[model samples]
Target chain A: MKRARMENELVSKGHVACPGCGAALAMRYVLNVLGPKTIIVLPACCWSVITNRHPECCLEVPVFHTAFETAACVASGVRAALEVKGDNSTNVLAWAGDGGTFDIGLQALSGAAERNDDIIYVCYDNEAYMNTGVQRSSATPWGAWTTTTPATHFKGQEKKNIMEIMAAHRIPYAATASISMPEDLMAKVERARDTRGTRFLHIFCPCPTGWRSSPDLTIELARAAVESRAFPLYEIFDGAKRRLSLDPAPPAPVADYIRPQGRFRHLDSEQIEAIQKRVDEEWLSLLRLIENNPA
Target chain B: MKEVMMGDVAVARGVKLARVEVIAAYPITPQTIIVEELSEICGRGELKARFIKVESEHSALACCMGASMAGARTFTASASQGLLLMHEMLHWSAGARTPIVMANVNRAIAPPWNLWSDQTDSLSQRDTSWIQLYCENNQEVIDTVIQAYRIAETVYLPVMVVLDAFILSHTSEVVDVPEQEDVDRYLPPFKAALTLDTNDPRAFGSISGPMEYQKLKMARHEDMMGAVEVARRADDEFGEVFGRKYGIAEPYRCEDAELILLTSGALGGTAKIAVDALRESGAAVGALRVRLFRPFPADEIAEAIGDAPKVAVIDRNLSVGAGGIFAQELKAALYDRERRPAVFGFTGGYGGGDFTPEVVEKIARRALEMGKPDSPTLWEAIP
Candidate 1:
């Protein structure tokens, strides 16, 4: 069956995003789903510079470019202002990069989540600080070689479990999504849109420049990532009820996901095996959570 | 209604009268009570505003900026360390032209963990393009806060209403809180000249080329310069409605004075008392209490201090490498004009020490004997 095209003039044609930029795709799908009545608070990230220079905007929605580590709190204030202005229908969205969400902006995000502010927060996880010349961030996976974590000194620490952190806040809806699966991604956005309190979406956006991968393979690699259980697609409802969007059953080997990206090119066989072991352990841990919550 | 209240409570009352739509603040000593009263007012539904108990001062100001960008009248208060933490967003709010009215209880900056009154806290942020209004007492604190909205909205610049920590913040005084209807008639609801509207989708704070960036900065600078007249008119109109007016700079008994004490904040009140006592002693001295610090009120100040042989600037706050901030700015303001006085800068009353009228009298007596300032700042009450 032919899938009808989902389109909105929400994202203009000539945004300065890199080709095959999953972050750009993620923004498009999110904006299309959320519609033009949405206001986005963008922090210091690639998109901060990507959305055309001053006096020229690239989106159909108003984007409030704010300081780093301020997206969530700014959105909280925006939502409150909108409510006071008798605009309960307009969506206030906080869009940030992984560094902004998982590291510098974590406190603000937690503050908003704890308050259960009436806003949606989306952290488009590009896995590293792709905006600032591919620096290592907390979201940079183990064994990934960013500029800061170079050559022999690949990222030794594991990617921070941001989902668990947001879940601990017990917000109304928290979900992990991927640009490879736009339908499921848009679905989660719709769910978040319907929810009144703080809704978080952790979107896996593979960076072509930062990952040193061909632009054409961005989506395929994103799909491979989920199938290998490297970045599972799941949701946590009120921090308890769990549901998987896509089952990583009979999962492909982690190497299948790792081989194409140059960021992981320095990994030896033993390192890959260790990573695979970690992946399996994490997958089992997630499966148990899904079973117990049974959403 | 006439009710005796602390300066903090008067600030909260003034914010309510202005009908501020959003208030986001973090608790800081000397500035906490203002937010506390606002929180209770918001909680009890006495004031129709959203009060966000933000986690940090940085978030407090950032939240205010966001709310203001979305076309809501926003307010926040912080001092000393909290104000320093919000330094970056201070520039952000003003550069974004948010028109957020913030009350800053001037507290001494740390190193020794001081929580006393000091003007250095807000004076350090002078370049951030925020219109700074220094109040002499609780009456001026409330009046300036309500007038801040009008001044800020008119010029599209943020306004910081500054009062001395504890000297004014905790001190209770009989203040005639203006009626809300009167305020409403005096100042209308804020309608942003440009806003983040769903009907009009646009991106704010996008990266700009140097040319456009410089142009924006220049435009903001021009508007900021015009805020003095706007503040003057707003205060005049506020007086017409509420029957109280504090000019940008108030000159008292300077008509035939031999010496004039240039002062700001609560020190102005003390200076007035000191001037009256000096007059009783048959000294031809007067007081010039400057209410507005930014858009400096140079013309009014220069005119007020005309031919007064010696002008002693009582600076309760000092700049470490330089001298008193107001004294420094005053020299610059008077440099281009003729008929200027030998300005004697006396720096004292830091770390919350009492800046008594006696100290003012002592400083004036010392200035009366001086030909000109021996140094940039004379460290008073120090061996």
Candidate 2:
């Protein structure tokens, strides 16, 4: 397929995002895909601080920094105001982290989705509350070690299925993408931008700092998660139709993904085997869903 | 045109006349009718606006704040628990300088689930830095909502127009609704000085350190301090356009009086009647009704009091450990005066209880015999 003209760099160098920050790369891809005619409403997340302080902003588009649990509603409001002003060309994007999407901001996000507000909401899932010193969030995978969930008593529950939760809202569109493939991520963003009401994109991001892995392993871990069926890439349309964006041709062992992260180092062989079984079941479930729905 | 409408409905009329661009609110008792009326207006195409019915008051205010930042005139309404729920965004909106207008029905706080007229709900948020205006009647309710947009847009701060639940909110009265043409001549369309726009690309509400943070706070304070004057001028301009005006702190029959009765909100009307009865009985008494509470209007209040040897202040709200809020703040306002009157603080008329003229008369006669207050709060009977 022939591509459209190249876009300008949106995320400039002045941003405070850390070294090898998958969130930074994801933001760069999303913003560049949406281009300069976009407004970003950021809630309390790593990006809220990583976007830098007053007297300086690194993004090329206008930004509105809102309260902790207000990203979705605020984005809806901005979209409403823009429409009232007779300017429908500018896109409203709500960029939030895992905690903001799955925990504190869940109600507001649900409200916006229920209203089918005209905006794009992207949740960059870093797996934990990495901004506040690696606190355990609902997004944290089971058996992961966080500050709140110590190594002795690791996380005992499953990570929240946020994409499914958003799809349940029956919004116009919802999709899952990973930073491991910039082309796929940007393609999903273009699809989201082309759509109208309440498009949700869940982007899997690897946090080397919080995961206690080497900075160079960020992209590799992101890729391994997809290759190992730990995180699958797919799209849901109108909450009814589903299609697989990427189905790994040859699935790798879950240990190749989990073994590198120190947060999951405490898991024994038995625990790892249980995780692999669960992953296999979930992957099959997703396949059945896509086959049945047939987008 | 003359119309008999409830205070909540009057608020809707004021908003319609002001040509508000966006309204986002949640439904709570007494405050519910404002949004209901607005939704009908929007649906009928009588008012060109967007009405977003949110799930909670927190989201309501958050949505309004965002719209305001996007250069749209915004409004919201809540009461009691709902207002309490919006506490964080109240401070956020003011600090962000969004200039959103909100109406709060003064309902009693819960514990026993009382939902009648009380000032404590709005008063509890005095420190949030939003300009607060308490009204005595439906007329003031409408006028203040219109004037609030003017004052708030001038100061770059949010405004809260408060009216007693069930008293002004549910009750009906005759009001001269201003024509839209007159209101348009008095107040112009909102053009946000600082806003979100992709054309220019600006960042708002970014994190800041002490060096810039404190200076921003000081600027907020200074502009807030200047808001009363802006409000007075707005009222004056409205009077010029529509032939009606109410001062920030209105003095009634206060010339050469030995005793003064000060009150706020709906209780002010009862106090005035009691003052008139006391004067008929050969007592030198006067009435002063304060409208503005956040800036406190200390200079205007002190000027209104003017050499009265005694003051009897009736407050409908409490601070628990502290006494009546208005009386306590009144003392603070008069402390710098060379010959401040001996202020007698009286607390009652809360929790949906009736505050009659007889209660004010009794309090005045009781305070008349005393040189000073025996206690911080003198009671006129409230359980």
Candidate 3:
């Protein structure tokens, strides 16, 4: 399949993001698609520190660095003001980490989504609180090792179904894309930009520092997750209809997705089987939604 | 035209007259009416503005910060816990130098879960770079709201206009709502010196080193001190156009008086009545209403309490380990003075209780008997 081409990088080189940081790639794609007429509402996250300090911001767009839990709400305000100022072409983008979006910022995100605010909220899911040094977040999948959820007591709960949570808000658009699939991510961003109401894009951003994985394996891991059906690429419309993005030949073993990362190195065969069971179950459930409410 | 309205409604009218572009608020007790009225105004198309109904107080102020940063004149109102919830964003809004104005109904902070008149909620936020104005009446509430925008915009700082819960917030009085054209002349459209604009892109509240951060903080303080002069000038100009002028501090019958009672918020009204009663008996007592708490109004306070032998500071809030918040500020203001008066700090009305005129007089008489404050702060009018 021919991949869509991107031109003119908005995210300049020499950012502070760790090598092979999926969030950096995701941001580059986002800014490229959204263009320069954008105002970003960035909450406290890795991206907050990743952007170089004052007088040296990499992104050539206005950014409002808000408190930890106010990305969506702040974006809502920016959109409203721009509407009042009669500059409707400028897109207000709320970029947050998984912790900011799924945990601390959930109320504000829900509020903005419920209001059908005119903004695109992007939650870069690094699975755990990476910027704070590998602390466990609600997005930390089952059987994952974080500083808070040490190897002896791995994460007991499955990652929070944030896409479903956003879908429940019945927003105009909500999609799950990946850092490896820049075309799909950019296409979703383009769609969200054209959409008038609240559009949520949950991107699976891999953090090599937090996951203790070989930095070169970041994109490989991102692709392996999707092919393994652990993190299936899909999109939901108006909180109901769903459309699957990929049709792989056959599902790869969950081990292909998990074995490379040190966070999952402690998992035994039975635990891996348990995780595989959960992933397969989740994939089946997602397929059911896609089949029932075809988009 | 003169219209009978509660202090909260007067606040809405003031916001309307100022042509505020965006308003965000959560419905908290005593502060709900202001938001409700603002919403109504927006609904009726009387005020061409966006009224964002935020989920919590934190989001309310955050929304205001965003709108203000987007170069909109923004406003919000809250009370007690709601105001407490907005504490972080209060610092954000001020440090970012967004001249957003907020009305805070003075309600007791909860532990006992009371929702009546107390100044502790707003007073506790004194360190945040917001200009604090305490209103003594519904009229002052309206007038100060208009002046707050001018001073805040001039100084690039946020302003928190405080009114005593129930006493001023719920009680109705005749307030002269100024005409919209006159208000327009007094307060122009907000032209933000810096904001989130695509044409001139810059980050708001980005990371800064200690040296740059210190300079930014110093500049904000300079702006805060500059607000004193701006506030006075705005009031003088407002009086020229609106025919009503209120100073940062109002000295009532304080001239040649031996004992002057210092108070703020609606308690000043009660103190004024108490002063009149004492004057009838030739007690030579007076009242000085400290209207502007921030910018501290130190010089005005010193001038008002000048040469007076004693000052009984009636504080409806306490600093716990320290003395009364206002009394401590007043003492600091007089610390470098040559003719320093004996400042007595008396605290009352904690957790939604009232400090009536009789209680205020009792505190005054006590201060008069003691000649000077022997203790740091004495509890009075407590049940």
Candidate 4:
């Protein structure tokens, strides 16, 4: 797929976002496609702080800074209010971190999906709770080092399959994108906006501060993630129809995605190989789901 | 037209009459019946509303928030652990001023994991900026639900109507479920002052720096405190239409009594009975039922207990290292008053334990004996 570049320069330069902050770029692209008529529902995450507390907003759209776990719920409320006033033209977008989406906000997100609530829920996956000093979240990849999971006792759990969970709800639309793929990401946003019911976009957002990598490497890491099939770009409709949006490009080694970041620095050759096997298994499973359910 | 019903059913009936547009909830003990009845009503097309089946208590509130923000009259019910799970969104709903109304079936929090009655779950959320109303019977539960919407929407604040777990939620009583037409005539469709207006765009939930953060918070606080009057007016209007009035603080037998018992929820009935029994025994004991919790009704409470030698507060919930939650609030209310009654606090009837007349009589006797104020409020019947 040919990735499209963003046109509108919605985000101004000299903002306070850390270099290599995938969430910042994700916001820029999302706003570019969503336009100014969009209302962003943000739960507790780096973006909440990154937006720079009230009076000084980074994005051109309206942002509702909600609690850590109520992003989907708040957005649902915002959408309902808009509908009531015969203002259905505005888009209600819930932008949350992996900790908020995959863990805390899962229940609300699931409920919204089951009801087919008219809203867009975007999960910016930075793996760990970066805003709260790099703590481990369910989205944190296995064998990673966070403040909570010291190098000696790294995270042993696999990153939760959030896309599968959202798919299980049988929502109208669900897709995965990455910060590195602006065109694909914006295209997914446009697709979600066009559809009704619960639409989810899971963006593979890299965090240089939390991942222990150079700020400039964020986009490269995101691209590596997709190329390695570690984070595939795909979409599901009604939990039945699955579409693979991007074919893996030569299937880059798992180490190509993991080695540059400090979070995975402690992994030995065998651990890296183990991660590669797990990624391969997940990729094959997803591929099978797509092939078996071709529309 | 008044028929006997459980407090939970009355709440459901009230929501129906109010023409709630959306109902979202997860089933929890005590609270499950309310949502079940609501769903059945929606399923039968009796109420034109969307009944959302949520996976957890947290989602219930979130779904309701969505519906409420969308300008629908939204509602949900939960108890104890469920209320605890919805803790995060409680602030969101209030901070956003979404005006969602919920019925909290007051149940004890877990660790010991009991499903019986307690107020800790909802009372613990005092700082969440919600307008809270506690009910004494099935009738109040029904009436309060209706009144909550009026107050919530008027102030642009969310409101929680709390009923004791089984004592009120499960028990049957005669309740006059108001007519839908009457409710419609009285409670108009919600017109949110602040909402997502695309034509005239505005920023919400922006980060506030030191310059305006405190002022914004103070404004919210003032609004919350102002809700006390708003709730009273709503109740007044409800009574004018329904012909029954309930004040923020309901005084029962407090006149010509030396000792007064402060109670809330279903225990108010028991306390009233105990007061009658004590009167028969020639002991001057009275009862005071608190209906509105948030805004505390501090002035009314202090005045209601006026000149009584002693006042005993029976709380069905605890506050850990602190005493009962109600007791703590009452103490704070009476802290600066001169010639205040010797307020005594007692924590009892927790986690579905019944508070009978005997228990009330025992607390009254103890309060009469202690005539003078005591620090570190006393526990009622603690082993």
**For model 2, how does the per-residue alpha-carbon lDDT over B254-340 read when each residue is reduced to its tens digit?**
888888899998888888899899999988889899899988999998998889999988888887888788888899999988869
Model 4 interface CAPRI class: acceptable
Supply DockQ values for each candidate. 0.80, 0.79, 0.77, 0.48
Model 3: which residue pairs collide? none
TM-score for the A chain of candidate 1: 0.98
Better of 3 and 4 by lDDT: 3
| Stretches of candidate 1 exceeding 4 Å from the true structure | A1-4
Candidate 2, DockQ score (0 to 1): 0.79
The alpha-carbon RMSD over the true interface for every model, in angstroms, is 0.9, 0.8, 0.9, 2.7
Ranking by DockQ: 1, 2, 3, 4
- State the displacement of the C-alpha of residue B182, model 3, in Å, after optimal TM-score superposition: 0.4
- Evaluate fnat for each of the predicted models and list the values in order: 0.78, 0.66, 0.65, 0.58
Model 4 CA lDDT for position B257? 85
- Please, what is the TM-score per model? 0.98, 0.98, 0.98, 0.89
lDDT of 2: 0.90
Residues B1-383 of candidate 3 have per-residue lDDT tens digits of 99999999999999999999988889999898999899899999999898889899999999999998899999999999999999999999899888989999999887878888888899999999999999999999999999999999999899999999989999999998999899999998999898898888887767779988999999999889988888889889999999999898999999888899999999889999999999987888999999888989888889998899999988899888887899999988999989898888888876656688888888878888885586566665754
lDDT by residue (tens digit), candidate 3, A69-162: 9998889888878878888899899999999998999999999999999999999999988988999999999999999999999899989999
lDDT of each residue in A1-295, candidate 2, tens digit only? 3443347688888899878799998999898899999999999999988889998888878998888899998888888888889989889999999999999999999999999999999999998999899998999999999999999999999999987888799998999999988888888999999999999999999998899888899999999999999999999999889989887978999999999999898999999999999999999999998889879
Question: In order, what are the TM-scores of chain A for the candidates?
Answer: 0.98, 0.97, 0.98, 0.97
Candidate 4, residues A1-295, lDDT tens digits: the string is 6657666666666457787799999988888888778877778899888877556666666666777888887677667656645677788999999999999888778777877888999999999999999999999999999999999999999999999999899998999999888888899999998998889999999999999999999989999999999999999988889999899867999899999999989999999999999999999999899999964
